[model samples]
Target: MTQTLEHEEVRIHRGPRSGLPLIVAVHSRALGPAVGGCRMRRYDGWRAGLADALRLSEAMTYKCAVSGLDFGGGKSVIVLDRNAPVTPELRAAALTDMGEFIASFDGTYRAGPDVGTSPADMVVLRRSTPHVYCLPEEHGGTGDSGAPTATGVLAALRAGARHVFGSASFAGRTVVVSGFGSVGSRVAAGLAADGARVLVSDVDGGRRDAARRSGYGWVEPADALGTAADILVPAAVGGVLTPETAARLAVRLVVGPANNQLSDDTVADTLAARGIVWVPDFVASAGGVVHTLGRESEGLDHGAAVRRVEGIGDTVRLLLKGAENPLREAKALVGRRLPPG
Candidate 1:
C-alpha cells in the first residue's frame, strides 16, 4: 500500500540553474518556527530526493515534539552525486545555494547539515543567512554537536539494554555500530568509553580505521550486524533493517542514530515476535535533535531537552510493558504539536 501523511506539509523548489531546492515535509503549526538541518545526499533522481526530504522532515517534527521542544521539523536535500562535496569551492557553492533556497521560507522551516554536512559547513551557509543556529564557537556557535548527539544515543542504548536484557552494564557485552558517520563515530567512541566492546564499521575505510585506532574492533560492513553482540546499533543508512537483515539480527536490543532505522513498522513487529526488543528509530535516534536544539545562541536553555530524550528510556520501558510500541506512545504524546519555537 502507498503511504499517507498523518502529520506534515511538503514544499518543493527546483532552481533554474541546477540542483533541486527541497523543503521536506514539516509538521505542526503550534511551534513558532519549524527548525531542521539540510542534508546533501547522493540521489538517483529529484523525485527520490523529494521523498527522502519529506519523510525525514516529518520524523524530525515528532522527534522534537516528543523531546518536549517547541520547534517543528523541516529538512533540505541537495541532490547531486555521492562525491558532492569535492573541493572547498564545490562545498561553498552548495551552502550558498542552500542559503538562497532556505531563505525563501524565512524561519518557517530552518535547515542545517546532515549526512555529508558538518558544523563548519553550516558556517558557510550562515554567511548567506543569519537564520543558521548550529555554528562553531568562532562563529558564535558551539563547534561539536556530535558529542551531544552521541551522548543521547548512548543513554538510549543503555536504557534499551536494561529494559530488554535486564542488564545495566556493558562490561562483557559486544555492540556493532554500523556507518560510523559524524554521529555514529562519536557514538562508537562514547560506547567504548562506557566500557562496552564496540565493533566499528563504516562505508569509508578511513573512518573505520580511525575507529579501530580508537580501541574499537573492526569488521566489514555486512559482518558488523551479523555478530552475536548483546546489542546491535545501526548508525548506517535508512532501510537497512528490512526482513532479511531483521531476521539475521542476533542481538537483544537495538539503538542507533540512523534515520528511519527500520524499513517500516513491519520490522518492529518482526523483532517483537523474535523477542528482540527493538527501540523505535525515531525515539532511539533523537540525538541530532538534541544537538540541534536551541532558541537563543548565547546559551540554549534546553531545560529538560537532553533529559527528555535520555528519558526515552521511560517511554521504551512503558512500550515493553504495554500493548503498543514506544513509537505509538511517542506519537500520541507528541500529539501533532509542533508549535513555533
Candidate 2:
C-alpha cells in the first residue's frame, strides 16, 4: 500500500494496417510473472483506457499476491469505440495487437480475459500469439475459467457466512446478487443451487427475466440491498461499495468477484466493525485468474486444473479460520515469497 508509482509501465501499441488500440501496463509488484486479463472496452478515449488498464493490472498483482499466488499483477485494456464493428479483420487486428504487446513483455506478463472479452477471443489471440489461455479446446482451446472463478467466490462466501452466522450453509437463507453478468450470473446460480433463496437484479431486463425463468428469485436492481437478505453479492463493478452505500448495507456477508469491491481498506474495517464478514476481493475473486493460468502453455490438463482449483477451498478456509487478519496474512504470504530485495 505504501508503494508509489515508481514501477508501473504504460505503453501504446500499434499494428501496420491501423487500429492498435492502447495497451496499458501497470507493473505494481514483481514477485513473479505479471499476470492479468486483457479487457476490451468501449473506453471513453485512449487516456481513459490506459488509466483503467493500469489501475486494474496493479490491483490484480496485489490480489494475486494476497491470495498466495506467485503472480505479479498486470492488466491490458483495448480501447475501442462501442460502435466499432466486430468485423473479422478488426477482431484479427485486436488479437494481433495483443500478440505484439505480449511480445514486448514476454515472461513479465500473462494474459487472460476480462469484461468485454471471452475464451473465444482467446482463440483469436492465439492466432497472433500462443500467449492466450482459457479457450474452449475444440479451436485448440483451453476452456473458460468463469466457472472456477464463480467457485472461488462461492468458497469465500461460504467462509464469510461462517464468520457471520457460524455456518457456511445458506439453506433457506436469503441472498441478493446484483449485475448478473458472467461472474455475477454464475454467482447467483451457485448461491441458489446451494439452498440460498436468491433475489436477483440487473440493468438488462432480459438477463433478469432469464434468471427468473431459470428459477432465481427476481428484484429491481436498486432493491438488492433492501431485500432483507443474509448476504449481498455485488458482482457488477468497482466502487459499488462506497462508504455511503456500505453504511446502508444490511447484510451479514459481502463477498463477490468484483475487483476493488470495497473501494478502499477503510471499507474492509467498516465491514468488520458492523459484524459484516467481508471476504477480501482479491482472495474471493482469484479462481478465474488461477483457472486461466492452469490452461497456460505450461501444462495442467483439464482434470488436473479442476482438481487444483477445487483444492483452493483449503486456502480459503485457512484465510477464514479464526482470522487474525485475512488481508494481512494473505499479504504476508506475498511478502515472504518475494526475494530479499
Highest lDDT: give the candidate number: 2
Q: Model 2, 1-341: lDDT tens per residue?
A: 67656445767776454475758586665667777888877867788787778768867876776655667788888778766666767766776777667766765776776787787787766666665667776876656777888888887787778767878888988888888888888888888888888888887888967887878888787777566778988788877777777788888778888887766667666766677767767778888776667656447776776666665566667766776456666666556766544
Error in Å for residue 84 of model 2: 6.5
Cα displacement (angstroms), candidate 1, residue 311, comes to 3.7
Q: Which candidate is the best by TM-score?
A: 2
Q: Any runs in candidate 2 off by more than 4 Å, and if so which?
A: 1-3, 6-8, 14-16, 82-89, 295-298, 322-329, 339-341
Off by more than 4 A, model 1: 1-8, 16-24, 81-90, 294-298, 301-309, 336-341
Whole-structure CA lDDT of model 2: 0.74
Clashes by residue pair, model 2:
57-75, 61-73, 135-143, 137-141
Q: Model 1 over residues 181-262: C-alpha lDDT tens digits?
A: 7778887777777789988888788885687678888878868768888888888788888888889888988888788877
RMSD of candidate 1 to the truth, in angstroms, is 3.5
